[model samples]
Target: MAKDFAAMEDSNRSSNPSIHDVSDPARRTVLRGGLGLAVTGLLAPLGAGTLAGCATAGGTAPPLLGFKGVPVSTADAVTVPEGYVTQVIAAWGEPVGVAGAMPAFRFDAGNTAAEQALQLGMHHDGLHYYPLDGSRRGLLVMNHEYTDDGLLHPDGMKTWGAEKVRKAQAAHGVSVIEIEWKDGRWQQVRPSRHARRITAATPCAFSGPAAGHALLRTAADPAGRIVLGTLNNCASGKTPWGTYLTCEENFAFYFKGPERPDAHQRRWGLRPGDPVGYRWHEFDERFDASKHPNEPNRFGWVVEIDPLDPTMTPVKRTALGRAAHEGATVATTKDGRAVVYMGEDARFEYIYKFVTRDRIRPGGFAANHELLDHGTLYVARFDADGSGRWLPLVHGQGPLTAAAGFADQGEVLVKTRQASDLLGATKMDRPEWIDVDRDGWVYCTLTNNSSRGGAGQPAVDAANPRANNTMGHIIRWKEDGDFDGTTFRWNHFVLAGDPANDRADAKGNVNGDAFACPDGLWVDARGVLWIQTDMSTSAMGKGDLARLGNNQMLAADPKSGEVRRFLVGPVGCEITGATATPDGRTMFINIQHPGETPSERSDPDQPRRISNWPDFRADGRPRSATVVIRKADGGVIGT
Candidate 1:
């Protein structure tokens, strides 16, 4: 969720009434009934055994492994199905091609900023495997979402030096490494020319109409055409032309107070006097909004990187608009135009989409490089009846005009959250990662809203039916006709919670493998949707959520709404970022921030570690790592 620093403020002092708490009693009753029916319809196929023998698009049965799920675990090691095997490919602090041959990782000492820039970052989030020759060997591009100051520095953020600040910055970007499936095992191809790292210090270029806009201009780049780095890169996506799209999320917390902060900055949760902990402004004047003012504006856009070309500088496509962007997933229009869908991970924020004007040209990556530069950005609005419309964010059209403080189209893209507010877009719970299936149905994870059901938060609605949605849910929608159309029909795919608490379906039935806080999501080529969890630290292993055990990965058949627990992570870790091989044999998942308990995050003095997963070091330091899973029988995974 947008629960970085700004979300912390909301949970602490916000008093606005929930938008979902309607005054109309009849409407509320109708919505409640509709939600129950939606859940029933979504899972109806599962009860009838329709999904038991479903086939992929290629007319072959999906490899669901048929291995019953391992029980929910709180162990200090990863738990997988009986017949599956997992191996750690890479972990934080490991060398990833700095020079020709990278040095070994040293966990005992603090790494310099230069060394960090060359190593795999701290928290591994979203990732993708791009096959080089259609299979086996490929480039793995992953996002280093954020940093853990408590672990990065022994003394923590309260006593950080200049080098410590820089090291943290270097550890907050993306990493690309070359790997291959050799002898039935996945291993990194060390020192390969294809391996590279993009850190917060790496230089980047800007594209699209908002590239050189006034709001983006900085002292370093007066022309506003270039930027220094990309920060808080969360989930990611791959383009049809072979490139990685890394999203800059929760960026507002990185910079200090703005010179002349406005409602826009406040709406994004960047307020003065807030102890962001990183305190980057103390070392780098550019991070201080008061000095550079516009530096924060340069980040928080969908950045595209070509992993195949190691020399290529990442480009921040500004036409996609800016916010706490979780990520962007793309699908082609019937006419071949590219459409990208994204979600702003904030409470009451809106989901967005961008449609390129020109059709995707067939050929090399250079030929279609500028496709995202020219497009119409839109925000979604779902009606109570399950129908929705995409409202275009064009100046002088509707409420996005001079009267609304927007000068032109550029302003609309830069201050997208403001434009969304002016257009009266529906305030959702917290929309996170989104994925589009082969059938063009889009699935989004609304990762919980603790502020809901309270007197000053958004109330229950048809789409977000729960008052205090502690466990979060998934919603799916199909466009009215095609990817380019504005109208669509949507419904709830799953309402995640603890099944033992009488959290039954519409027919009073519950599954044994219940989960909460759906975050990372991916759909394999075999049509099996992979769902990951990120439970709140305070709620983990407590109450209804405790019964669900640690965060885990679940496989769901979208056609039947049947979900099965596939794997569970160690204590105090979130199971996220998943991708499977073309044949669905090798699957990669990210285990982030293990051993970071609620007490460790809040009470630094009396810190307690929960786990030291991946490497169960006796020193009590945990490292985030990526694990590769393949069936022992060499069959397609998740069968």
Candidate 2:
């Protein structure tokens, strides 16, 4: 979801300590020596390979990033370095190859509600590639974060009814399509058994400690075990046991509540009305919060889906805790216990981690069906001494007693934000996707927090050094011993901004390319850190962010801190959701909401004014699509 669309208000009222409140010596202690040693120590178990220029286990090393960097691009087009080829594999409104329905995308923006469901959903976000046979054939699963109603309908909100609402709902969720590379290019395997769509109307089951909680029960489902949908699906992750974790982000705005909402509803960003301009509640009674308050609770959870099996129902793992979840990144402990790191993707919110108690069994999905159901969730609190601790959100522990409004573990997980607040967790700058490198270091993207150090807002902190942080930074940490360890040493990997800027705060310490608003993050199989930017449409070509040009993706050598622009997106689009084939030769990236006007809505009469990306048809509307990139010589991506 777009930054302006999500909750921008600072809801946290806790007086917890900030990292800047500590002594100056500790506040500035971003030691590189400590990080170097930690990375070197963990390398052995991860096959002890190379870090860009460092020697590998075989005493021979290859450069991690081998391509020349592309320059800043402002034109309404996709740009990449020389010797690279790009193709549009999947786009919004394209046929998803459902067994009975395979409707082609209408260039006139006239796809019917039934046709939209049969075709690809809108606003492609976090995605993953599950290989079936090496890199030649696989399942490409991606989620549609949200829909722009203006472009969805022919009249653009001039008419409203249940049919329009159904179309929008159908466009919000996950899409799994089997794609195969043959005869020179990748093509969708039509009528694939793996082809499936899990939309907002799809049936989903609840599991874990909070499954049967009273707060989740509604008139439609008295058992509290079943829900109708999963919307606002953002960045995703893949479990070692062959499942996809699609996070529910910015789910609050989907509902409309009474003039005065309860404290619980207000904390999760539910306001008095649809200030974000979502009109779903008008036609769908289930979205009316006053009639069904529990509906929002059913969302905001990490929903797991098995892309290989179309018959398996999607499950919302409640043990991971409810939040405006950004994405879930999974890393296994040395002992094989699964540790999942997550970001809340909201201002003044906290980062979270879940540690499964049992070691991962080896039977894929069968033996580990209940793996995520049994886990202990913890929130992070970064101290100023380059150290951090993961505080357990278990009920009756610390201040999480019954008197504090938490009756049991179920309530604690449902109201994870409040629980984290009471525990004095460190509030981050819109924490987004989190990724762990092969060397066992955890990295998170703290996309900009404009209110930091503002009047009546939280002040500058060591962990978040910039007040009114415009260009977001990436923070990383190495766990003490195990992936599930409670303690860890932390530091800033890079503060993103223009190195030539005159202002002290905006002049970030970037080693190479200048960029802003780091959002999507991925540490590839070979330990290359890929950073994608999501510059707000309002700030893209204006003022301080003008030099950054359009939204772009960059490749960075984590050890050397050398950043280089890899690709730039078309006008008014976000470069997000990246994945690669098993061999690393074929890479996929999604361009979301191209031609998105500054107002965040396109005029129905002139949908192509801003961009017509991928098609460039005179009558075509801007569509969110996946860009497939591969080396001309079929070498590994970014090399």
- Which 10 successive residues of model 2 have the least lDDT summed? 31-40
Instruction: Flag regions of model 2 displaced more than 4 Å.
Output: 11-26, 29-59, 603-608
Candidate 1 ranges with C-alpha deviation above 4 Å? 1-6, 9-65, 98-101, 258-260, 502-512, 599-608
Model 2 C-alpha lDDT per residue in residues 411-434, reported as the tens digit of each score: 999999889988888888889999
Residue-pair clashes per candidate, as listed? 11, 0
Clash total of candidate 2: 0
lDDT tens digits by residue: candidate 1, 1-639:
313343564632233333344333134221221122332233222211223235668776544435687788888788999889999978988888645647566665366777788889888988998888655888888998887777776556556578987888888889998889887688888887888889888899999988899999987899999898888888988888888999998887777876456766666666675336567778877888767778888888999998888899899999899878897998998889999999878777779999999998877578888999998999987766666789999888998888879998888988888888777676777888999875777899988876665676666776777766777888788888989899987777777775446543211112336788888888777566788988867778666777788888888766556678899988888887888767777889899888767642523322236676777767647888999998898867866
TM-scores for every candidate against the unseen true structure: 0.92, 0.95
lDDT of candidate 2 vs native?
0.85
What shift in Å separates residue 192 of candidate 2 from its native position after superposition? Answer: 0.5
